[model samples]
Target: MLYIIQTTLTLGFVYSLVALALFISYRILDIADLTTDGCYVLGMAVSVTAAYYGHPIFGIFLAIIAGMAAGYCTAFLQTRMGVPSILAGIVTNTGLYTINLMVMGWSSNVALLKKETIFMLFKHLGIGGPWMDLAIVAVIVIGCMALLRYFLSTRLGLSIRATGDNKDMVAASSINPRFTITVGLVIANALTGLCGALVGQLQKSADINAGTGIVVIGLACLIIGETVMNGKKNMTRNILACLIGNIIYRFIYAIILQTRLIPIDFLKLVTALIVALAIASPSLKENFSLYARRRKESL
Candidate 1:
């Protein structure tokens, strides 16, 4: 039980980074970027393959670069080809499936058993063998959140946020909304790729399907965070919400797994339902309040 909780938190922290990427494009940019599913897998494949070649750190860097390329592809379709934003994302995502396969060098996947990964560095530093993975992941999560918070406070960062808010207004200010969107996508995808690499390293394998429905999972995290943190527009609150929501989401998943009633095959469906409920909760609450008010008026 304790080990399960630890595993959940470790995996959850890596996933929270992906969720943060979703938050940047979805909530901040108001764009539905579906490239997450493929880019995530691409990251894992790139890193694991690189590790197989005995360049583990370089593998991580390659994954980030690959993610950035995926981001650029999506932005290019939207900005240069004049495709709809969502459609552009879909196109990039479709292309990435092939790209990921190529990165794996015609292999279906890669497994890095007995790998010397970032987690190993924690152990080398005397962080304790049993707790090393969790400790490393926790440090990475905190570092990312802090870096993102600082970036969002910068002038360019403010412009990016503004672009998400109102593209036309940002354009009117001569900020070039397309540039902002492109940069935002690049940053989001880069973080997501790093997450994938780290997670693959932790798990000791990278499967082509590892990133299936990743966008949905990220959305679930974002919604859960927003609900728990009340969706405050402030930077600090929003970042903190992502962290808290990630921990809670992992705990919920752990609980569900413990229940013998839910088969492993049904897990995806249950997760989807949970995400749907989280997304609808605010509207449901509003409707209930309106109903109570109507009853009072009638009385």
Candidate 2:
């Protein structure tokens, strides 16, 4: 049971990174950038391939670069070619499938059975033995949170936030909304690539389909976070909510899988249902309130 919790926690942190990335693109930029699915897979392919060639750190960095490049492509299509944001994202996402395949040398998948990874470094510390995985992931989550908090407080970060809130206002203030969007996407995808690379290391393998449904997972985390936390007004608080939501979400999934009440094969269905309910909770609450008001009037 402890091992299960630790594993869930570790993967939760990794997923939180994806949530953070999604938060920037979807919530901040107000764009439904679907490149996440393909760019995430691209990261896994590049990182694993590089690790296989004996360069772990370089591989991770390269994965981040690839993800950023994919974001840049999408942004270019939107700003330069006047493509709709969704269409631009789709084009980039579709292109990344081929790019991921090429990066993996046309292999459908690759495994890192004996390769060294960041997780192995934690094992070397001899801290909690089987629980070391959780410790490593915890440290990573804290570090990422700190870095993001600092970044969001900077002058440039404020501009990005403003652009998300009101593009015309930011543009009137002499800030280029297009540039902000481009930079935001780059930063968002960098975090996403890091998440993908970490997951690849955790699983010790890279599969072509590994990134399937990642956007949904990320959105689910964000929605779950907002729902549980009451949507704190502070940016830092909201970001923390995202992290907490990720852990909780994974823990719930772990519980469901462990209970054996539902067949393991139906786990995805359960996840989808939970996410849908979470997303609809706010509207449901509003409707309930309205019904209550009507009942009082009728009475």
Best candidate per lDDT, number? 1
Give candidate 1 misplaced runs (Cα > 4 Å): 122-127, 281-299
Q: What is the C-alpha lDDT of each candidate?
A: 0.86, 0.84
Q: What TM-scores do the predictions have?
A: 0.92, 0.92
Candidate 1 lDDT over residue span 183-250, tens digit each: 99999999889888888888878898998888888888877887889876698888887777888888
- Stretches of candidate 2 exceeding 4 Å from the true structure: 122-128, 284-299
Candidate 2 structure lDDT: 0.84
Q: After superposition, how far is residue 78 of candidate 2 from its true place, in Å?
A: 1.7
Tens digit of per-residue lDDT, candidate 2, span 1-299:
87787888888888898898888899888888888998899888888888888887788889889889988998889978899999998899888888888988898899998998767765676666786667777787788888878888898788888988886698688888889889899888887887888788778789989888888888888888877887748888778878888988898788878888778788677667877887688899999999999999999
The TM-score of candidate 2 is 0.92
Give Cα distance to truth, residue 253, candidate 2, Å. Answer: 1.1
